[model samples]
Target: MGVGVRVGVFLPAAGFPGMDHGEVLAAAVEAAVAAERAGFDDVWIAEHHFMSYGMCPSAVTLAGYVLGRTERVTVGTAVSVLSTCHPVALAEQAALLDRVSGGRFRLGVGRGGPWVDLEVFGTGLDRYENGFEESLDVLLAALGRERVSAEGERFRFREVAMVPRPARPMLPVVAATSAGTVRLAAARGLPMLLGMHVGDAEKAAMVEEYTAAAGDLGGPEVAHVAAGVAYVADTTREAVAVMEETLPRWLGPGLSGYRPVDGRPYVPKDPVEYAGLLCRLHPVGSPGHCADTMLTTIERTGVRHLILLVEGAGDPALTIRNIARLGAEVLPKVRASA
Candidate 1:
């Protein structure tokens, strides 16, 4: 395990059964503020469009908002859906936030699902299926150099100077859920953001693949981030109970809302079963158990930075409390052992 295990919060801005978008977003901001106060290292915002699962449409915009609200913690998108966004425009926004936030902003981009977002954003289904690499290339170019142009199969443009250059050259963290994405990120010498749904073994496998693929680049060590659910209570039972009571109600509707643009047969996970799996996979227990679980994950995945999804309780106040406990109670133990 690494000498220091960095902890951060994942504010999904999840819209539970009865909550409105305003309330969801408010809870997210409150959680971010609470995580910072609790002494966590970062706050990562999740982006989802036109869904009750996650209400935030523009993660970069929300990241800017979170950055303005906190002074110390790093703020980033759990992922900004790259397939649905114009790479140059998103890079420009990332650079602006990086400049204003004093390099506290991290742009985490992913090839989002085959959803209606492509149609709504006017990027189309082909971009989601085949154009992500080109988009990523454009994004990297726009961020790496003062002037950029693209003459790719999907995008063609004349050169334009990057205005208001970032505090440093932007190196966005690419979200990797599959081999192709992992290889793409590794090829670019970019760090990866691994998803929460997988087990320790699976995450470790992804890390191994990334490490092998990234071996030849020989740059500074990449700080890969792992996302997981988090909850804390005096007893493991109490923590698990809370997650069981609330997570399914939130997950059921949210997971079912994704309309696959390719007309592929899509079967959403059974929310109750999924919630149980998350409880088993994540740190949903007493502080001691949570700390131990984190340590084990770190040892297995070789990933030192963790971004925990703290909204599993599906209540604003409880989510904030979870963040507080994670930072104040769980983080100390993890760090001490690390």
Candidate 2:
């Protein structure tokens, strides 16, 4: 590994103030293009339903689109909601994407949010846990074999085969965060994706758990890829200023009652505490500061892949510029430190 760490960009497929739905999607594409040109490793698209919070209800579709538009840049779903689709269809589409992209596709799956997704998908929160397990079984089976069957609690399929099989022998599956989901990923020898909200201590504990769970029989030890907001500016003050203005929109009431991965009871925080925690845990500062924060995280924990949440960092121009600065000013220093 040249740097022992890889940096990816988390494209915002969600709402933005003054930006229309079409523009947000287009901006995400532009951001991916810029990130690739800026030497970023991969692009992960998000999935949401029935809310402006995240406009991309189909991360797989967006992944396919991005794959078609870019060369050499790996495209993945930050998560494609398993609860929302027929697993066989999802596997076929994902495989086709991989085939077309010449094996540069990754599949990241998550049990989706509880609000509009649950309401629209007609899945009560009660079923989410079991549904996720069942859906995952179907997805994994479909991806690995020509024909598969699953008599899962919520889903049952017989002799289903994914057409246009994946070009590569194996496509990487990255599981997003949840309390017990890390172990779930490890048991299958798959990697896990973490989010910004997880504090440093929790990340260390999670990584330890994954390492222990993946002992001995490892094909690859857990690929712990974490994501957080990042923007590079001439000064920390400028970066913080931009974040303060745009964060309210990104963290708006749409996420109210959102249950954290640790299963902690949701508690409203004072603005000061929130802002303080944001700076303490995330990279929202000058290019040098950004490099320092990333290096610190890599040192503290074994996280090697970071998906910089740059979609809402600023306007389209600023977001693009942040990618360039991170690639030029920050990446070298951070990688060199390795």
Candidate 3:
């Protein structure tokens, strides 16, 4: 089989300095176009509600907008938190987007963030996993046009037919999960989008568990394992500098109410510490080094698809250049080695 690495740009609304909302959107759209031109196979957008970090709260809407601009690139939701929205609404929106994109839409779902987001939605954190499971069942049944009637603890859906079915019968549905949710994805035979932002050891354990569970489920296609990381500049020093400058603002006191580890916030206080953490989690280095890192990661984890989180670096232009560099210098070598 031919090897493919799907590179995506994560669009965050919170601009670095000297950039506003309109500027950020414009820059992100430009970057998406650049990614397409640079030969990246697919692009995925994220969903977050009431967070300055994620501008696109509605991923399907943004994917529709991006679909209008690009011809060949596959657009998808990196992880639409299923617990927050009604399954029928999400199904209808995804179906419409799939039609608009001529079947270039992929669906990625997750249980969502911890307590803070749950509070915003008036949902208890304890119900996150249950809500996700119920929502997924509703969504899949709706998409398949199955007469769904369920009276679960979290959701109750009567016999209903969701209109505007997706153009493709079997649209790829990926489960975005960490260690806690990996087994669920495997047991259900869903492809996994592994979060690489969590440390390297965690990522490795997650991959290992996912692979073993997938094997138990009859060895289905090894189900695409895509890992993501915030890729930065040409050198280790520049990468650390970028991380140092952006981490505090990105994970500032706005999130103070959330529970911290040992009274320290979930985010790191020192830039160097954060940078070291990111370096372990992400493949941040020169293009050649990054390529080698990706290859090694693929060999170790057997992940077929890779999503590089380039927008975290705080410079749109630099992010675009890195995309080009990765497409030109990184992907080819990786493919050749494969």
Candidate 4:
């Protein structure tokens, strides 16, 4: 048996039509708490606002709530959009969450995926990359150092100090992909969280790329977390059939960036075609199959931390059942054999 890997749950609290907002959020909370009870190591919440896909507008807020509710597992924002707010304010919120959580808070910041929120927030599209980079610089300085200073294309500040500094080490960056983003993370001496959309082959290559990038930057070894959909059922046939039925609907506009072969976004086309493509990127099968897939993923990606981004179908009951199965069947086996 190899050393076990860290597994975390990515909370997807939806605000679908006809569903009360409170109920959706409550369901997500219950699921997260169950995952912790299932012996998961962390719970991650993604930031999305005014969207039916994900009702949660504030990952930090939800993270704090989760931390307060749970005792052991770390709670973190899968990513908080960096360009959406001032660096100091984001830093304070993160640091305060850490303190409140008794150092069980992990933060992941990103430039954010596509949405109309940029215009809504009045952050123009032009110079977005520059602005995001600048924001990250300022954010890292504030979290890691007592005094923060920055002069950049989007922001300019001088020797500002964060009043409530982080109690633990500053949180690592999540949702960092692309060679450019990996290089940035390496330069900052932080780990990168690879997206769930990535396939095993791509994940392995990315690990290599990140390692080389860190070496070139004369930085420390760069740790990384791999993420993807995971499910375990009584039979492989049942699991695959279930995923094919539920996942296409689950893959909405939010996941348009998860390009399959031909390097194009997966449009809703032939159901069979789309499902096949999604399967290439996800793991869904019997317990033994899921365990084998996870083991192969770890071997290929060299990532010790694995985040199960999707559980059961949209059905709440199925979601909870899958979590239980993962904990009871797959998790123990993986730990013993990893």
Candidate 5:
């Protein structure tokens, strides 16, 4: 509503049913370019390993690829699983992406999900909080051109200078948080990228707590508080159909590894049932309906940035068209009201 209510579209590089990996990756690059041309402000990619649902195991790498193709739209990892990758390497890749994108790169970091199968990669989940924090410290220090000497519980670094610092002295860092990670982000003075599935009540509380805590830390006011929600179609009925058809196959039990939330159930047996549940949290309807829902949510939550996960929609073409329509029709009205 603040005129800069950024509306972004998510590109799920791997999750589409029967989508060839190579073609899906290509579509992702194309989607970034299309989103930019369609007047979106930012494009986000996710990080998940060994999962058919999300092919981008390394968002930094995919971001680099997007950088080569798009010129104006900002590119970012919806999250880079910081607990699994070395901070120095992560910093280097981010710096390189910033360079390629000409300073249009933002960063989102988080503790890797439990379902990510870190054990197979010889990584332990114990001390994840420590590792996530230290990695952020190291990344920030490296970006600021300072030699880092970190000897924490999970990792040890000895006064090593990382080269090729980001073009921007302090790259925009958004810490991905839910109920569990919100306090951590506030403690570290980082902006937050709320996850895709939080309910309305929880989402509002998160924004309030984050803003208050960030103020107390004397940190820069949150640059953006972005929430991810699935956007399905041009009409409520059409949207319902898409969600009904796709949600079950994708959320089936065999794919439990894709979602790491504890005790969260997979998709419901009936599409209408799932649609009803998701609609409470996601914006899924016609352009006008979506606009109204989004505006109401933003007004209530004070969330400045909105990232719509159109990737789950059955048809990519429909998703792209809806995004363009949202940009042209929905955002302007919302901004006027704000």
Candidate 6:
């Protein structure tokens, strides 16, 4: 049997200091194209609003652009925050992209933080806290059927047709951080996008929970996606040095930009410590080390797909090189082992 392993790149459109918004966006697009050139299977775009951490407020829109720029690789939204967006509207956009991209677009949705975006978008904190489930239900309904309507707590709308209906039913990838979200995805027969900061054991447990929940719903076989950092070099020390040098500069200001709408204290991580931790947890080393690390993660979590955050070097050229090196050097060993 063939090894069912897929590797993709995550482009955060990170708004690091010293680079303008245009530069950041251009870099993200460049990385996506390079990912395809490097033989990766997909490119996942991240969404954030009013934060230096990520400048892409509209991940679906960006996915469309990336789809236009690349031919073979699938382009997905790492997550379009569902709370601040109308589910139907996002679903329509996803459908449109799917048609235009020839079924290459995947919509990944998440419950964003209680940030000021809720107020700016007029979605309110209740939407962030209690409305995610309702929004997800509406999104799923809109994607699955041609004609749909919602009479839910947060949304009440008459039946409407999904114009330019999707050619194929699109199953969204849910970003799961806790049991509640994991169960939510599992019950819906959806795949979870596990986060980067989590360890293999934690991810394995979440997978177990999801499998158990899915078993109750007839045990459909699912392939979850694990997100992690990726950087490579001739030696482990060289790779670690590059990440330590570049990641902290971007992680600091980018992380500090979050503002809680409810006046809650929001403390960003210590960039230095967090970068070091990520280097340890992720595939940041020589080719052998990188492969071994990813193999362990795949084995422990039973996740067949991996979406790696590849901009740790904080430079467009270096990030592209990292993607290429990973595709050329690290992925072969990983594929062989799996």
* Cα-lDDT of candidate 5: 0.69
Q: What do the candidate models score in CA lDDT, each in turn? A: 0.90, 0.75, 0.67, 0.74, 0.69, 0.91
Put down candidate 1 lDDT per residue, 177-225, tens digits, no spaces.
9999999999999998999999899998988888888888623378889
Q: Which stretches of candidate 4 lie over 4 Å from their true place?
A: 1-4, 15-18, 216-221, 253-275
Whole-model lDDT, model 1:
0.90
User: Which residue runs does candidate 3 get wrong by more than 4 Å?
Assistant: 12-14, 122-126, 170-180, 199-201, 215-220, 230-234, 253-272
What is candidate 3's lDDT per residue for 230-305, written digit by digit as tens? 5546786676666666655554532332442123247524544554676666667666667777777776666667
TM-score for all models, in order of appearance: 0.97, 0.90, 0.85, 0.89, 0.88, 0.98
Position 223, candidate 5: lDDT: 61
Residues forming the 10-long window of minimal summed lDDT in candidate 5 = 253-262
Candidate 1 clash pair list: none
| Comparison by TM-score, 2 against 5, better one | 2
Q: Can you tell me which runs of candidate 2 are displaced by over 4 Å? A: 1-3, 123-126, 217-220, 256-276
RMSD of each: 1.4, 3.2, 3.4, 3.9, 3.3, 1.3
Candidate 4 lDDT at 19 equals 60
